[model samples]
Target: MSEHHTLYAAFAERIDAVLSALELEGALPPGTSRANVSVEPPRDPSHGDLATNAAMVLAKPAATNPRSLAEKIVEHLSRDPLIESAQIAGPGFINLRLARSTWTDELAAIAALGGDYGKSAMGEGRRVNIEYVSANPTGPMHMGHCRGAVVGDALASLLEFAGHAVTREYYVNDAGGQVDTLARSVHLRYREALGEDVGAIPDGFYPGAYLVPVGEAAAQEFGDRYRSAPEAEWLPVFRAFAVERMMAIIRADLQLLGIAHDVFSSEAALQAAGKPEAAEAWLRAHDLVYDGVLEAPKGKEPPDDWEATELPLFRSTRFGDDQDRPIRKSDGKWTYFGADLAYHMQKAESADELIDIWGADHAGTVKRIKAAVAALSEGQGEPIPFDVKLVQMVQLLRNGEPAKMSKRSGNFVTIADMVDEVGKDVVRFSMLTRKPEAQMDFDFAKVVEESKDNPVFYVQYAHARIRSILRKGADENFAPSAEHLGLLGEDDLALVKRAAQFPREVEMAARTREPHRIAFYLADLAAELHAFWNLGNADQQKRFIVAQDANLSGARLFLAAQIGQVIRNGLALLGVEAVEEL
Candidate 1:
């Protein structure tokens, strides 16, 4: 009774119905569940259009051999109108070849849906919060924050396409000690701006000249009022002013890469609201924290002030962490982990699931945070799902040499500088070329190349070639229609099979939370398009536009249009553009 129009889902439903009837007929065994049944495309397309391991997976549970179960399932599958043939393959796998008309109908469906071709309702509008690019508000965004921002944005877009209500969030670390250092650095610049002799930036202070503008602004506003004040008097004022300006620079830098977070949760605001104390009180009520002293740190050198003094610690050992984590330092101030726990507790109130994308350096913090969330959500409605993805570093190379430094950012390569060198689309597409956990080399000369090695260019060229074909038709209303679709041949039908995989790819990418798969899929789809176009070079009859046969040409052109549509949709999810011309 469901109105899901996905082709794979339709076949899955039929397969389930066939299995249920066999169960009711008392042929195999009663209580044989079909929960693990999966009707997906086969590993080898030469064998069949679709394959299922239902028989193989269910045989042990049904108390029968796999071959016997496969034969029974195929007997029922062959009776379906859409199936051309069904055969049992190795180890009781049922391979089915759907009718050619099924492929043709799918082409028509793509035309009807256009850019919305591969969207799915599998998420059922569940609330998911994705936190990414929580760079400290002390400076401009650098290349270090690029990968996480792009991946997190693409993942959020993919989830939304799959019917999830996703919130893209950014956590502001304004309450940390780093911001205090930033404030002191700005004050030094403030004195310099007021015509005072400030020598080289001292140790433990930020050396970047990007804060000069903040200092000039501060000096102009207050005019030496806070310049001679004590650290305590000017610390709060400087922290607020510098952090606000730094965040503005960061937002502008992010906009260059086509990213904007929906929520900017401030740690300082959380402290002001007394959330951290309330969260700790709840943990104490549950006995998840205790006053404990630690032994010498294992597998690492202890800090200089390491002592056995008693301090409040969370019992993370009970939840899988290697050791209990201290929530308060010897100075009686909350540690970073304590604030993080309260932040996550705040997140759980609005999100059904949470995901954080972090740099590779934060690998050690993952376990304790997971434990904190597990302890906090004990009595909540349905424990929230939490995942942390670690994104590896990107080594910048310029023609096999280390890339030159950026002047705009003062210390590191800025996102704005990268965007200026290579356009936003190229930056986004290149960042997703590899898995997030693998270190990648981003070569400036190689990324902008017009060769097949550059996936973004290759995919965009495929779309442009198709657009050129349709524009040559000379009809203002020229669009891919289902009319004359039966004129397609075996070669054309092969292209249709590739197109049919779009819906499957989209659903899989969304379910796995890996939008990089979409990038890989588009590359494969582009290769297929290139191959199909090359077939006409050897045989004029294979050309998409036949001057002597308009009907057949219309059919081929329709297929090309549908392919271009899917490429556009995939690019949209990655926040890239699909150009109409090379």
Candidate 2:
């Protein structure tokens, strides 16, 4: 979508042009749509550089068979100067092999673009709000919350690269039962700070040692002010103090993994501002919410205390949810979903798109929120697109065995612990190796290993190796440039083809909102660099640093530099550093 067009986009445009010309000649139907037509790299590289199903998609409307239509399209495409050859394959696909000059041109473009090589204007500056790692401020973030943080962060980076004005956000569940418990625990520590006989933390209170510091800090700040006060007099003050302290801990923990949210929206702030009340009133006017609900949820045993109390419920069933969701509990308290919807409603007013990253355990909640967005659009005029990505759990492993709790946080393995065990780059890259929806194991032993199975090390090693080769070339007065890029041969062209795919890969991944694809791509690029390096081990002529041939050395070194730059860019999106040394 950028002003600087990539080869993939160019080819797609050319195919569209060909179809437009066919329409002019009445060879194809006048109103044939080409929106679904796509020109992409062939599944098998040996078949061709690119393939398109344009012929097949248009053949039905043209009143012609796919084979004959493909032949006609190929006739026009073969005349293109950039295309070496065009042939019909399968039932209707048109395969194209681009001239070698095209690959060289793309490499030159990569050189000109540098860090911005794979960037695109696909997002068109639309505002995107991405909320991730909304972990309750009850405790420090553990591996339970790490995947969502990494995924959301990477996705925000990816969208920005693809030209979106993205805001990375976190929701503070300060007005929750969990935070109240956190306050109670802090109070115990606060009492202990006053040298009281608060012997041991009860079973319900948080006993993590991390809060000891918070208690000490609170006691030093306010001496015995709440020691004898009633719950009404002290709860609010203590809750405010504790939530701030808990957030500080959460922010520091997120920083260990290179995450810092752009905004931290508070549930307490929303409630205090009467946002939920306003949302409920608006929904009532639209008939989206009503006083209803008495049926027990299926598959769950009814609690003995359960009563058929009429409560206010959202008409989520009108959309995709299985049943109406209660917005207010029987006790007249707003449900978590109701408050969350108000938070999302806040998001809708400012952004063109809304994306929430949540744990897979919250999968049942996706539909209701989506319904809320739809209902909001119905009441309002404009639409705000919303999507929720669920990240599954990460099982911690050490030496091929399940790793246990963190000594630092007490309850679970904290993100800080993982970063301490194996640096941030390893933690970030390893978390992204799998798609968010699929469960994965973070094997500390394997992640740090120097082998192909270890993507973090393997990919970084490639960049480091390339840097070494470039340094050697630097000593020999060999410089890479577009002027010497023409020395590349068949295998060299293959490498360029792979490099050129970076832009297309970035665009596709951004379109799908899948940043994991970027990690997979970097791994493949690393493999190519390593495989090409191995060729140097067996043959001296294939070496990047050749004292006998300065021209060849410059060309090969140029290719290496481009590969390294791309690796750096891809790793940057995943919030991992591209190390020059392992």
Question: Highest lDDT: which candidate?
Answer: 1
Off by over 4 Å in 1: 1-4, 298-305, 475-479
Q: How far off is residue 35 in model 1, in Å?
A: 1.3
Judging by TM-score against the true structure, name the best candidate: 2
Q: Give one digit per residue, the lDDT tens place, for model 2 in 1-582.
A: 335676889989988888888899889988788887988999999999999999888888899999999988999998999999999998999999999899988887887788898999989999999999999988898999999999999999999999999999999999888878888889889989888988877999998998998889889988999887787787777889999998999999999999999999999999999989999999999899989755865557887776688988999989878889988887777899999888888888888899999999999999999989878855667768899999999888889899989886887998888889898889999989999899899888999999998888888999999888888788878887567777887877888899899988889999999999999999998898888888889988878877798888888888888888889889998999887765
Cα-based lDDT at residue 206, candidate 1: 90
- Please state every model's RMSD to the true fold in angstroms: 2.1, 1.6
Model 2: lowest-lDDT 10 consecutive positions: 292-301
Clash count of each predicted structure: 0, 0
Each candidate: what lDDT? 0.90, 0.88
Per-candidate TM equals: 0.96, 0.97
Error of 1 at 572 (Å): 0.8
